[model samples]
Target: MSGAVSWIYLDVGLDTCTQGHDCQHICINNGSSYICKCQGGYVLNADQKTCSRSDACTQGHECQHVCLKNGDSYYCMCHEGYVLNADQNTCSRSNTCAQGHDCQHICVKNGDSHLCTCHDGYVLNGDQKMCSRKNLNLTLTFEMHVVVLIHVLMVMIASICVNSDKSYICMCRVGYVLNPDKKTCSRKKPRSSDTCAQGHDCQHICVSTDDSFVCKCRMGYVLNADQKTCSRKNSDLYKRHDVFATVF
Candidate 1:
């Protein structure tokens, strides 16, 4: 036999092929080469030497019902009590009640809503948005007028009573008596016969109802019943009346 190149035995009980021999459709190991199989969720490259991630979601290319696309994968989520607006990235809640009702109290706006409450000194009306005045029937203006009128009348009566008291005191002054008219006082004067210093005309005289007398007259009169004394009325003229003597 001609000289034959001996085949080398590789490690681990494997017969190694000689260089430049073709092995069809089977894996061959070189000094540092090894074969690997693609796992789940991964795909082998066309040469079958490497693996890459298999994006299953992107393959379908469609998301249903609250699912969103992120890169090559899909994520599922729902809006927070709201919905995406025409621009899918933005969200919006309803604001139909934002301005609230047209009433007395203030309207408070909350997220997506509003409510109504009464202001001070008022109560909520049937509509819940309006407020009506408290004590609606009470009339403060009229009550004030009535109180003022009463006070004025009381002041007027007090003034009249005060003036009447002063006038009554003045009427009781000395040498005066209450007139039967009750509005005046008059001096009590004696009759002509009882006048004092009855020579000249008496200027004034006061006689008590008890038959006593006080008199004022011009000079030259003697006290007598008539205001004119006997010496003044008739020089040496004497007249006599019942138990009384007078100069005539």
Candidate 2:
């Protein structure tokens, strides 16, 4: 009806309301344009609208030829001839050579390796790589003559000491008597008590050589060659006395 009618108007901007919404979380608004944020451990693409995963490690920086991978990083290592450093970006030399002339065994050194060997009559212990003398046997013996000589000397010394210590009592074997000097024993003394009567009785005498003895009568007493007893030699005076007594 052409007769004055009222028209109702709705404003889109005023009516549009975002409640409990977050930028770069749920969505990002830019002049009627929107974008979504990437998750953790990821980055947005160059378009800034789409999300793409980030590559922190690229090119050779990612890992070495010989390396292990972890959550977000890697480690570098080398072979026998090379050694890796703390940074994991470089390598260095290893000490495998012997020091000075102290090394006796043959030594071989690689970039990061070492070995040792011993010369003749020697041996080397592991890890230490040092040489040492080999074990050997020792022999010893004693000659029979030497042993006999030592025994004889000891016996002589013992006898001298015993003789010097005891003065009154002398060492004498059976069938023997101590000489006047008290240093030796003579076997000339007879078993009869009459021969040894006064300590110094001279009934018999002995001649000693080496380790043997011989008995003989005193000068005045003649030994009846039979060794029975001492008797006076045949005398002319004794015979005449016998004749005179008979005549009487």
Candidate 3:
């Protein structure tokens, strides 16, 4: 029996070992040979049939903050108050107010931007970059003597201050022209040919004057409530039509 060939072995004709035998991850079959492969986040063990944990934070990893090992790969993640940068390999401050904030009073940090806020007794202006006085109503809550004293003090502080029914008017700078409303500067002298060039909203004609312009309508039309637009007169429109009435 020692020199004799063993005929007790039977061939099943199926290559199960070469197909997927003992592969913990993937099995690659090459004819009568086979190779085992591990999925992402796993490495082929020394036995070549099982898989082991792959260190995601090892060399060749490019995570910004934390490198999390998933089922078959790894992902980059950021920590609190930080976000992955554009390159995805570094972290930067997520607050938007970290950069150049132009807020006049307060700069509230947001997720990726900032908000402007005014302090007490101040309100944000139309431009939102500056603050203005909060109590613009001009109603006097103090005694008459106090009001008079305040007005006197304000006038004393400003040499060119002038009070009017509507509002206070300030003196214009040299070579600058005051507007018709008498509150703000309109333009400079050596004016252009057209005085209404900037804010003339006339629907028909704008007549230039010494310092400003007057809005005028055509011959057949009259000025509307806006004083800059023209409308057909009711008298002229009704004159062309005959009126009739019926009593029920």
Relative to the true structure, candidate 2 reaches a TM of 0.27
Model 3 deviation from the true structure expressed as Cα RMSD, one decimal place = 17.5
TM-score for all predictions?
0.22, 0.27, 0.32
For model 2, the superposed segments whose C-alpha errors exceed 4 Å read 1-26, 44-55, 59-69, 93-107, 111-116, 120-248
lDDT values, one for every candidate: 0.49, 0.52, 0.69
| Candidate 3 lDDT, 1-248, residue by residue in tens | 56977676534565655544779988876455677899876889899989988866663578868887664567788887787888867898787666568888888986666788888657788887788765434533344235346447655332244444433445655655566654344436586777877678789999988878888998868998887999876774555553422221
Pairs with steric clashes in candidate 2: none
Q: Highest TM-score, which number?
A: 3
* Candidate ordering by TM-score (highest first): 3, 2, 1
Which segments of model 1 are wrong by more than 4 Å? 1-83, 93-108, 111-113, 117-122, 125-135, 138-248
Residues 118-224, candidate 1: write the lDDT tens digits: 77657788887888766523423453344336447644221111122112121334555656754344566755564333443434434433344554444444556
Pick the winner on lDDT between candidates 1 and 2.
2
Error of 2 at 213 (Å): 47
User: What local lDDT does model 1 show for residue 236?
Assistant: 41
TM-score of 1: 0.22
